[model samples]
Target: MAQRDYAMSGADARRAVETGLAAAEWYHTDIPRKEMKALMARADQPAIRDTGLLFGCMALFAGLGIALWPSWGSAPFWLAYGVLYGSAMDSRWHECGHGTAFRTRWMNDWLYQIASFCMVRNPVQWRWSHARHHTDTIIVGRDPEIQAMRPPALGRIALNFLGLLDAWQGWTKMLRNAAGRLDPDEADYVPEHEAPRLIRVARIWVAIYAATIALALATSSLLPLMVIGLPRLYGAWHHVMTGLLQHAGLADNVTDHRLNTRTVYMNPVSRFIYWNMNYHIEHHMFPMVPFHALPRLHDRIRADLPAPSPSILAAYREVLPILWRQLRNEEHFLTRALPPTARPYRAELHRHAPGVPAE
Candidate 1:
């Protein structure tokens, strides 16, 4: 297996375009236009109810944690708060960024901004970055959000559980953007017109973080920092665990979502926190469908998708080994075994030439 470059400026990106993999037409399950329209319809009720639960829980946990500070009782409350703030916010940011989480445009933007702050992601930059992700998902040189690149950085992935690497990179990028410097990869996806807005948002984020730090110092307590800054590091594991199953060892540079994306059935609590993003293949196939409607969408397209992993544990069982194998054999990938009812994979149309393997 050759060492394949995953950087946006690398040869793979140029190859993806030349090979017609970048922004190429992808496979979609056939559905009646009227039925699809109904599924894609945005509604306020579901988003409203879910948002209420999320904020309500965060308030409850934060209040309890604050009141019980310096006591063991506060530990559980803070733990709960961290997961909601750090982990759940990832999904919220994702769905809201798509502007499909709520029927109301302002509602989506409001939550998107809040969640982006919680996750330490620049909303303006990620909006464009994610658009590229959807346009060229898992394409080696195109998608900016490829979570685990091959000959996988095992150490970095481990540190990311504590949000160490991601926080460092995110804060560094934020500061750079605040300094009016956009990285080449970012400039590649984000429009020139959006650069000013991105810088402004980054500056605002830096100011808020500075304020939180000052408050912590003024009080001679860690409370403010714990509340605003630290949870992203402490509570990131759940999202990282689930997020890794998405495309960790899947084929890259491929046009088919089924080849690179995964759908794992998770428990009810996980579903709520992940905003139903567990139905990842369904979400990728029809991004316009709201998170609340993913299960219904999954049912509609079940016969056309690979058999979903029965649980998160099941997904990891399959994914972990593939990742380990890829450490030595970068060309190796788990070709999802689609069900008999599913559409056959177009192997010939794969980005790699016939008899040549894709990285």
Candidate 2:
């Protein structure tokens, strides 16, 4: 099969969409999203192994503290530890949710569960929502993940600035809403499966996470109790803020394969923080493509993707201007869409690495 060619620029992105959407089989294909992801090249072994160990260590020690000695300090180190581990765990969960962390499906689920210990958010729940994200990312009204912050307009800026705090508050509010207390319709979560066994697992997920919270309240001091809240906020905002720089308000409102994903020109600092997720367009086009593999993929396929609008760091800086425009209601978000390409972009893989062609 000939490689698909891509034209660079927001204009080319749009064309890719028209081409894809025009295809008769697109809507009817039975290819599962998971299989599509796995078809990408394998992830880098070193990065995957190292990250797993690091997060694993953090989770282990934190769990020990939470269980054995809940009051070693007045400030609640366990709480702080929980937050840090929670954030890192969520990162692992994100990777595992894609089934890229480990080769075995059951192993990935177990790893995801460990990460979920502090988080308590059921891995299954996230998997279902996330699968939808991969399928209909960035589509307005259709993609459940894409939505304006409440109160809309000016409130969006305020919400982003409040950053982590807003995320923490939202989580708390979600717990409240789940109990029929508050209404955060924007969160938009739906049950994943209805099988009795699945429901039983979901109940266990709820129980374990709730037990962690209960343990904190019973054993830790007031200061420690506050620490538990910090992880939820930090992880939520860290993920969102990074994503905002990644593709938020950057792509056109369309949901085609290429246009839905984006790349952010990034600096070394941001790169480390984002774990190479900055090459989001590459990731989306090839979801199974691991973080470490993105650079290689980019070098191969750069000509096909939209030319770097701004480096990731530059993109973050530019977001303020975009936010201002959004605040003024000029645009809901600052997203770019590509125009059509004359031909699909292909890389000469064997030229550089033995089998890896430049796309």
Candidate 3:
């Protein structure tokens, strides 16, 4: 079996383009144009309500954490605060990046910038990166965001729960970008014209971080960091947990999202934190649909797609075994069985690595 090369400049990436997996037309469940338009319509109310509540709760938590600091009573408040800072900001950044979070364009841009800062993502760089993600998701060498590669490094996944790897890499990238350097992969996708804006944002972030660290030094207390820098590390678990389910153990280089993405049913709290991204297939199929509208879109399209995993736990159950098997057979992945009401997989376009046996 061939070991998967996930580099943008690797042989597998060349194969992906040659095999028509790069920028190829993907299968989206047929939805009437009128209904899709309704679903895609932008609205500010839902996002406004959610954003207010999210930040409101974060404020309450952060205040309590500060008041009760130097006491173990502050522990829970800090923990709650971290998830909002570390995890929830991720989805906020994501939705706002798509420009569907608010009916007003400026609202979306404002939130995208704030959330991008909290998450250490260069707004200009990630905006283009995410566009590429939608264009060629899970296509090795083309998609920059394939988190779980073949022969999954379970250790790396574990470390990321504490934001040890991803956040640190993000900070390093910010520093490099601050120095006006674009790594090869970033340069490939990010527009040359946007480099200045990306660099400017990175420098601003570096300044903010340096100030935050300097404040900690001046205060002789870790308090400032707990609110700013520390939460990203301490509260990274929830996002890491949910993020891995997006494409881990799914077929790569497939034109169909059902073949690459998994949607799991989650509770209200998780839904709120995730911004309804649990409706993964629907979101991918119709990227224009707002996060608030994903559930309705999912309802309209689920019949044409594989059934969603019943819950987050169930999805991990389904994915973990396949990842374990892929340790030996890199081609190994779960070909999710579609319900009878769903259309069949586009087997013709399901490009597997050469020499891999079809199930």
RMSD value for candidate 3 = 1.5
Checking candidate 3 for backbone clashes, the offending pairs are none
Off by more than 4 A, model 2: 1-39, 56-86, 116-120, 147-192, 195-202, 220-229, 256-260, 265-273, 309-312, 330-359
> In the order shown, what is each candidate's alpha-carbon RMSD?
1.8, 10.7, 1.5
Error of 2 at 107 (Å): 2.5
How high is each candidate's TM-score?
0.97, 0.63, 0.97
Question: In terms of lDDT, which candidate is stronger, 2 or 3?
Answer: 3
If the candidates were sorted by their lDDT against the true structure, best first, what order would they fall in? 1, 3, 2
lDDT tens per residue, model 2, 1-359: 12212222234334434544211121111235665454465544745565666666556655666566536642354544543454555556677778776666676677677665445444544566566566655433334445332113445534544344444444554355344342322233344232333345545544554666787678765434344444554334445556665544443334433443557766664464456777877776667766666787776666555665477556666555555554444234442433353123222211111111111
Across 96-202, the per-residue lDDT of candidate 1 in tens digits comes to 99999999999999999999999999999999999999999988788999888887898999999989999888999999999999999998888999999999999
201: Cα error in model 1, Å = 0.5
How close to the true structure is residue 140 of candidate 3, measured as C-alpha lDDT?
86
* Poorest stretch of ten by lDDT in candidate 2: 349-358
Model 1 per-residue lDDT at 187: 84
Show the colliding residue pairs in model 1.
none
